[model samples]
Structure formats: structure tokens, C-alpha cells
Target chain A: MDPDDLQAEPLSSGVPDLPPSDIGMSVEPATEAGAESDSSDTSSSSSMLEDDLLVLRRAWINERNSPELYTYEGAALENLMELVDFQLQSLDAQPASIQNDRVKYLVRSYLRTRLNKVEQHPGYVLREMKERLSQAELEYAEGFRSLQDAHVRKSFLDQFPAHLRRVDEETKDGLKMVPEPDMDRAVFCRVRTTVGQFQFDERYVSRQRRPAYLVQTTNMQCVVRTRSS
Target chain B: MLGDECFKLAKEAKDVTPDHIPAYNEELVRLVTQESRYLWRRVVELIQATESSSQQSSSGVFSPSQSTSKPDLSSQPFSNDPADVSRSMESENMQGQVALYVHTIERNKRCLMAYHRKRAEFLQSLLWAVHLAPTMVPQNVSQRLAPEEQNYAREYAKLNMKYRDSVEATLCPNDSLDWALNGEVPPRDLLIEVRVHRDCGEIVTQSGIVNLQAGTQHYLCRSDVEHLLTIGYLEHINPT
Candidate 1:
């Protein structure tokens, strides 16, 4: 009945365990049983249960209205908390029942239904919440890693080493060629920081057609040859 | 019906003047659209692997082109009559109708998937809401139901649970909601009863409290009454 009482309590710490029988005190016994005399008693009980349920429903609605990013686990916890609020509100909103026997029965139903759900699917909410939190952490780490890598760049020439070499050749047509390097070309390329390797070979045809140059290299690889424009 | 309509217009083309080309054009569009629909359905069947024959014919390869690439209608030679040729040409003009169908089906399938995903997300959220709500009990618990009503709910639950395997067969032949909607509407109020025991207390098995607020009339329109009735407050019936 009092919103203040609920709001005053620290909801984040989790809901306090409620006395089972006292949760829903508003449900009235069915009219058929005590139609003539106990109508008031029935109404009183029903009203109490209804009020508490209304409050619980409101709490659940509020929790659900959270931002788009809240995980299902958090949502589930919010739901459970609201449900407890609904039960408490139900007790205060409706008049207390005179029929203790009926009240007991109704309370037992509420507890059984709820507790069964909790037991049947134990720790489901907790697991979901933890998973969402972990996912958020992972995403954050990925973003941070990406940010850290902003300065990193692969050598532009590395992607197309052959193209870079061709440009250099076009700029300066003739370079010294020692037809066959007297020393191993590999050792020279490795030791000299500025030295880069280039490969070329000419296959001789029967002196009838233009000799085709066969060029290959580990320096650059292309899935398909791109013809220079 | 569209195909039939097109067929009628094509036959009457001889009687109408050349100016009545508009009528022929309209009929052509309808015919092509219908053909496209047929092609679309077949293509979808192949793509979804719903065609048993296609699945059995090939060990593992899935090629829609094998099933749908050739227009089945193409093989049906057009009548020698110039009028028939004209009509067929108009129908064919509707832009390789089968191609249009494939495009539309793909788009719709994507939309359906997105819609289902969003709906699932919403339902998940709703469940969470229900879980959190206050400790409230039902507003009313009916007194013991008359013996007859009790027996009815019990029998209904029993039938549903007992024949559950068969229920799938009986409920909808195609089992797909789309197919069910297109087919005959199933029966109303085919009730089933099953006895469910609770740890807290025993609900009267024979009788139930019906909340007038919750009724089958709406669900009956969208779903089979039998299917809807199979769920809810069955074991909670008040016994007389």
C-alpha cells in the first residue's frame, strides 16, 4: 500500500525473504462456498491479493522499461524483485482475510508456483546476467585493442612489393646488373638494410618469337595477375 | 483463379478488336504473376530442402537451378494461332516471372526471420517481467466444480497428453503455421485433461475455475481451439 516503504528498502541488495503465508492476504474465498454470509470476507481477501499483484506488476513494468542494453539476466532479477513487491503490495492493498483456511490455501499456491519456477530453473537469471556482463567486458577489450592498434600499419610497399620495384625501375631505367651475382644474392639482400631482392629470367624460344620474361618472387604474391595500365 | 481468368481472356481475344489490347495486356500481367507464384513456391521448397523427391534424387548437392532454372511452361508449345502467340508473348513479357518470384521469396524470408527474432526477444523480456513481479496469488479460486465439469477438464487434459504424439498429426497436417492458415480451419474446443501433482498442494482435478476474462474465442481465430485449450489451469480445477 505504501510505495515509500518499498523504495526506502535497498532493492539492489536483493529482496528480503518474505513470510510465505502472509504474502497474499487479500484473496477472498469463492462466492459459491459462502454466498450468503461470508461475501465481505471473500471480497476483502480478493482485494488484498489484487492490490499486491498490481504493485508487483507495476514494478516489473518499470524494470522492463530499462535501456535497450540491459541483459536478460538483469531483466529477470528485476522481474523477481517486482513480483515480491506485488505480493507485499497485494497484502497491504486489500483487506486482510477473515477466513484463515482460505487465506492459507491461496498463500500456499502463490509460494508453490513461484518457488517451483525458481527451483525448476535454478540460477538461470544469474547465469544470464553474468554472461551479459562478460560479453560487455569482451566487447570493451576488443574496442580497447582496436584503439591501441590505431598507430599500427603494415608497410604499404609490402602489400605490393613488385609494384613498388616497377615504379623504381621506371624512374631509373638501368641499374647495375651483375648477370649472376658472383656471391650469393640472398646473403647480400639480407645483410644490406636498403637492398631488396628482384627476380627475372628470360626463356629463349626457337629464335622465332619474342622471348617471354618469366618473373617470380617470394617478396609479393598475387592471386591473379593485375596488368599495369 | 488468375490463371483461369487469363485463359478466358486469351480465348476471347479473337472476338475482341485490336484496340482491346489493353484487356489482353491486363490478362498477360495476371498470368505471368501467377506463373511466378508457382515458380516461387517450387524454388522455396528446393531451397528450404522441403522437397523430399529432390532430396532423395541427389545425395547431398543442392541446386535450385536444376529444379527451377527452366521455365516448365516454356516446354508447353504455344498454339500455332497468332493470337495465342501474342498472348503468350505478353505473358512472357512480365520479366521472367520466375525470377521475380525468387527475389520476392528471398526478401520475404529475410523479413520473416527478422520479425521472428524480434518477437522472440520481446517474449524473452516479457517472461523476465513476469518472474520479477510481486508475491501475489490469483484473485479467485473457485469452489469445487460440479462433478461433470471436473470430469470434462480432466478428460481434456488426459486426451491431450495421451495422444500428444498423434496430436501433432491431428492438429495440422502440414504442421507449418503458413500451411495451416491456408488450409481448413481446425475444430473448436477439442479439450484434453491431464493430472498434474504439485508439491505445495493438490488442486482439484475434476473441476476448474474459469476466468470469464480469459476466453478461447480470440485464439480460436488465430489458432486451433484444441491447441489453445491444451494449455493452462487444467490441473488446478476445483473438485466437487
Candidate 2:
């Protein structure tokens, strides 16, 4: 599959999953409660569909690039999952299955990426962080920590000291014995704006090529192309 | 000397062959944990020594919560007081030692976590790698795993098998075929050219059973031959 085709979607970085309510209404004001009027209806609905896909793609890239767990794109994921699964039920050898397959692959990759990250530091993610994981992911993390704890007890108890066995124990100087993401790690990005005086970090940006000023307030329309190293 | 075992453990994990699991260094893990225990004991001793000095120097100045003492007060507060200087100096020395030991212990914990997590991930990916070939981790590979990892691998394989079967059933209940284990995205074309690198007796395709002879070429429907390409019976010869 040409990932570039779905590259219509923008990557997220703490970006909200869906466009804000006002931006959504402004994008397609008449289509919300409009009846089955054929001409304008199809066009509006297709455009809305395109917008939804863009948000989903953004979530995909954002999830891919972030060092730590980005915000869960819960709403976008729910909408895409329902739409693809519903389409896939009667999808008898149709070419459209290709697109559905792409969606499935993206969702699977996104979820798996998060799952791998969670596995790497289950204790840290569960105990130190908040709201970055979905409810399902949180439960899985809890289960994983307990499972590993039980496994460690069964395997390493005889040799390991009792006091040192606790992985999350803090030291006397208040240093936590847990893995943490390096927030200052360098990341690559394809920038189209001057990005002068970024609120997060001024040094992370410098150059610009083509500046397209966006007046809309939708966080889902992420203009930056993440090439995070 | 402080974190030498941990340093070696991380290096050993990285030095092994890329595609194989390394032997678990249980001895190094024990030594590191033991190091952490000793460091903690030393820190506790330092804290006690500093706490006693703080009490004696402060004289009649009563500290309510005497368990945890704070050296947070700057030199300006103690500059005018003569007795405070000696206590502050002693506390400063102990705090620095405690800080260094604490950082080393945390570093040791991270190294230990890195080693185990690396081995665990290798076990997880192995299940997927051996899916189309042999189902289970062969006896030789399983022997290399720690006891906990072996159990993890068994449980993970079972979970993957269940997930694959359910997904296949949901996708194509009547027709028995695969929904995954293909190219990342399904190829665009229906017909694809393939080269047979090895000799195989016969395999069924949509047209009919084709004799998969050695060094033969055929333009078969992609659906009929994609699985063969995956299993190394055939290779997809891209048209130039």
C-alpha cells in the first residue's frame, strides 16, 4: 500500500483527535441535519469522510513519532474502527477492501506501537503518568505488571535481595528507579512555516519553505510533517 | 566498581547475534541487585549520622518531624551562627555521598530493566517470526530463555494463535484463508510473476495444480502464489 496515499492524514502531537465543534460546523455547516438531497449531500458527506480520514492519519503519525505515549485518539479510532468493520462484513472481493485493509493495518500498527511502549515500562507508565493511555491500554498495563511481578518472583526470588526487588523503589535523594523518556531527544520534522518562537521549545525549529497560514482552529489539521529521529 | 556488573550486563545483551536470544546472565543480575542493597544501607547510615549531628548542633531548636531532615537551608541562614557551620558541613558531605549512591542505584535498576526488556521483546517477536515456518519455539531456542521468559513465550504464542484464528474466522468464515501474514498492504495487481528457487512436487492454484519445478518461472494470480512467496517456495520477480 502506498503510505503516501493515506498521508492525506496529518500527524498528531498532543493534537486533539477531532476538529473542535466550531471548526467542524464551519467546515460543513449545512450537512449536519440535511436530508437525503442527492447533489450537495454526497459532496458534503465525502468531504466529511475525507476530513475524518485526515484526522486518523494525523493520529497515526503522531503516535509513531512521540517518545512517550501521546494522547489516545479515542474518538477517531472509534469512528474508523466502526466504519471499517462495518464495510468489511459484506466486502466480497471488492477492490474497496484494499482501502479497508489499509485502515486495519494502520490501526493495528498504531495499537501495537503503543503496546510495545507500554511493555517496555509498564511500572513507570502505570504509576507515574496520567491520561496518556486509553482505558483498555491501562488495564493491559496493569495486567502486564502483575504478570511480570509474579514471573519475577517465581524466577529470581532466591538470588535477589528482598529490598532491591521492588522495581519502582525511590532512593534517598528522591530519585526514582524507573525508565523515563528523554524529552530533549532530537527529532526531525518537515516544516513549512517559519515556526518562530514556538511555545514548547524555541530551539527545535529554525527554517521554513512554504508557509501556509491556517486561520482555522482545528488541532487535527497538523501542518508539521514529523520525521522524528 | 559501583555499577560495573550493570554496565557489563547491558553490553553483553547488545553484543549477542541480532536474531537470536542471548543466554540470561542471572549471576550478573544478582550482583547488581546486591550492589543496590549495599548502597541503600550506606545511604541509611549517612542519613542517621547527619540527623544526629543536626540535632546536637541545633541545641534547643526543636524540629517537630525529626524523621526526615532537610538540608535545604542555604549557607546564608547559618552564616551568623558558629555551631551551625560544623553541622551544615557534615550534613553537606553526607548528602553528597547519599546523592551519588542514589544515582548509581537508579542507574543499576535501569540497566537491569533494559536487559530483561530486551530479552522479553525478542521472545515476543519470535512468535510472529516463526508463525508461517514452524509453530513453536524449537527446543534449542527455548533453552536459552530464562524460566520466566519461557512461560511468557508459551502464553504469548497461545494468545497469537487464538487472535489469528478469530480474525480469520471473522473476515472469511465460509472460505478458509488468511487475513494477515501477507505484505504490509495487499499488492495492487491481480497477476504477479514468480520464480521458483527450489523444487517442489505440486501446489494448487486457481487455474489448476502447477508443477513447481526448480528454476521455473510463471505468471500466476497473486492470491494463488502470495503464500508460496511467504514460505520461500516462490519469489515475486518484480518486472523491471
Candidate 3:
């Protein structure tokens, strides 16, 4: 028998077998709603086919550069490399989006830690900070949980406004709303309730004058601060 | 992409049934495959040639048996005239260049091991991919196992295992050195000599040698730097 007479398909990434819905339909966009609506049994079979294809594609991608698999030649090897390059290009093109989503959680984490500090620190506004902080904490948790089911986590983060610091009447008339220098710009958003919308021009500065958005607006700044020792 | 072009060529390049190929375009496939194979083999040959030259220089400096087994000639070799062949030979007889010898020996052993391991793995995977092709093999393995390929596979596995240990042990020392250099070097006693320099409060070593990976100038040292190379403390120094 000749060595060049066989036929085989590529392998898939060895992901733990997932539930049918996640492993199957989620890989590619569902193209046919008619096929889905006509028969549940047929839908399940088509879903399985999609699942198998995903498995095969993922396996080939994972092993593309692995020394354990394909090399620098042949059609299969070339296809695997092309797939990897495409994924890499996609990743590069969406850095801001990915970072924005990540920063959303990081901001919540930062605020949670700060709220803990506020609880420990002594001040007249501590009580007000504590109340708003607790509310923000609850909202952040709820938002995160809801985000898990969304199309993308970043858009969910964009919708979350709990990390914003509200300029409210606590005790001090003058206030400083300072943005964390290292905070990711993507997740950092400001909302002015008095204007009934988000504000772009009103930057976070370490001083207080009149509210920049509106006369009686609830000006909120998503800022980070260092706890004074 | 090159892949698409190749695929189109393969798809449209006339029927390669038993009537067309070298025994079914067998000879053409073999020639293309062998051309790539020969390119890599040429690379290995160059590596061997360089290694042999280094070994010869070392042997000229000192014989291996004399130094590892004997102790009388260590300090005396340094006195020989660097220009005189007879004196150099006598010096080599007295004290072998054990340090250079050991370095080269270890290096060659590592290179040969890497060469074999990489070659085997590449061949194994390449063959595996070819086997998976639509028109490549018969229906069953029993019919597909050519005696030569069977032997090649066994030999590949053996070489793969043999060199696997060496490859794993051979790590680049860039990261650890970078950490140490960054934290301790500026204020420490170790003087910056040769190409070592400080950047952003980090001590870094640089040398001028071509790098194999990415063929890019790495930030660490040149590829030919003779000191202990580990991935932990070494990085390639990119010119830019």
C-alpha cells in the first residue's frame, strides 16, 4: 500500500465535554431559525454536527503551533497556521474592547476595597460614604451576575454605573473628585444626573466649584483614591 | 495567503491519479518533500561543521584524556608562546583547555540532541499530516504500513525520547538574570564589563549575534554568548 492514499479529518481541541447548547450552537451564529422551529429532534442533530465541527477546529487551532502536532509545511499545517493568525489578528484589533470589559470589573474591585477602607476610617461623611458604597457594592454584584449571560462582558460593564462617585451633601462643601491616573480610560465614565445624561467634557479634577454638568445635577465621577495612612 | 495559492494549485494542477504522478506523481511529491528535507539537512550539516571546527581548536589546545585523568599540567600551559606551534602543542600536552573543552563538549552534545529531537518531531508530525490526507493512504493501517516508514517511525521515537530530556534541561537564563540585573546590579559590586549595561535601573547584557527564534534581535544577549544560557535570565537583544 502506498503512503499517500489515506483520508482523515483534523482533530479538535480537547475541551471538557460541555452541555450541548454551549458546545454546539454557540460556536457559530445560528443561521436557520426554520430548521430550529420545524423539529426539535432535527435541531439537536444539526447542533451535534456544529459541535463536532467546533471541536475539530478548536483542536486544530490549539495544536497548530504545538511541537506535538503539525509543522511548517503541507496543506493541513498551512490551514492551521492561517486559522491561528486570524485569531491573533482578531485579538489585536479588539484590545480596547477587551480591556474595557476587564477594567469594568477592576474598577468594581477597587471601589469595593475602598469602601472597606471608608468603613474603617473616621469621618463625618463616613456614614454617607458607607451608605452609597454599600448600594454601589450591591449594584456591582448584580450587574456582574447579569453580565455572565450577555453577548459580551464589556458592554455590560459599559452599562454599569455603580462605581461612580456621587457629589452629594455629606458635610464638606468643597470636594475633590480625582481620577486614578492608571485607571483604564475605557471603563472610566462620568454621569451627571442633573443634566439627565453622561458628560464628556467635565473631567475629574481635585477641586470643587459649581457642578459642571447642571445646576443641581448629581455629578458622579468614577475616580480612584489612595487611602491615607 | 500562500496556503490558498498552494491549495488552488494542488486542486487545479491536473489529475494526479496513478497515471500522472511519479508512480502517480510520486516522484514530484518526493522531489518537493526532499527539497525541504535537504534544506534542513544542510542546516544540520552547517551546525556540525561549525561544531567540528570548534572541537578541533579545543583538541589542538588540549587532549581530553590528558586533563580529566591527569593533574600535573594545569598551570604550565599558560606560559607557552601563543605563536609557536611546538610550544602550543607542548602546552596542550601539559594542560588541556578543559574549560573550553567542557564548554564545547556540553554545547555540541546539546546541539546534536536538539537537532535530532526537532528533526524527529517535525518528521513525525509531517508524516502524520500526510497520512491524514485524502489520497495518501489505504483504508487500513495494516495495508498502509510501509516497512521503511515503520523503521523511520521507530527510529524517530527513540531519538525523540533521547533528546527530549536534553531539550527540557536546556533553558534560556534571560528572565532570572534580568530580575537579578534589574534589582541588584546597579548598586552591587559586580562591575559592568564587556557589553553589560544598565537601562531603566536594570542591568542587561548584550552581544552581537544572530538569533534563531523570530530571527529578531532579542533584548538579552547574543545567541553565541558562551556563558550559561537559561530562559530564566536571558533574552535576545533586538537592535532596535
- What's each prediction's clash count? 38, 1, 41
Better of 2 and 3 by DockQ: 2
Q: What is the per-residue lDDT of model 3 for residues A82-166, given as tens digits with 9 covering 90 to 100?
A: 3223333444532222222121222222222332233222132232333433333333333322322131112121222232112
Off by over 4 Å in 1: A1-69, A72-229, B1-37, B41-99, B107-240
The positional error of residue A171 in candidate 3, measured at the CA in angstroms, is: 67
lDDT of 3 by residue, B2-59 (tens): 1232233244233223222211222332333333333334444555655665576577
Q: Who wins the lDDT comparison?
A: 2
Candidate 1 vs candidate 2, DockQ winner: 2
Chain A TM-score by candidate, in order: 0.19, 0.63, 0.17
* Candidate order, TM-score descending: 2, 3, 1
Worst 10 residues of 1 chain A by lDDT: A220-229
lDDT, model 1? 0.29
- Which digits, one per residue and each the tens of the lDDT, describe model 2 over residues A1-229? 2222212222234333433332233223223222333444556554655566656565666556555666666666665555454344444344333344445555566666676678777878887664678766776677677666666555544345455567666666676656665544433343333444333333333235443222222221233323211
Docking class of 1: incorrect
Candidate 1 Cα deviation (angstroms), residue A212? 72
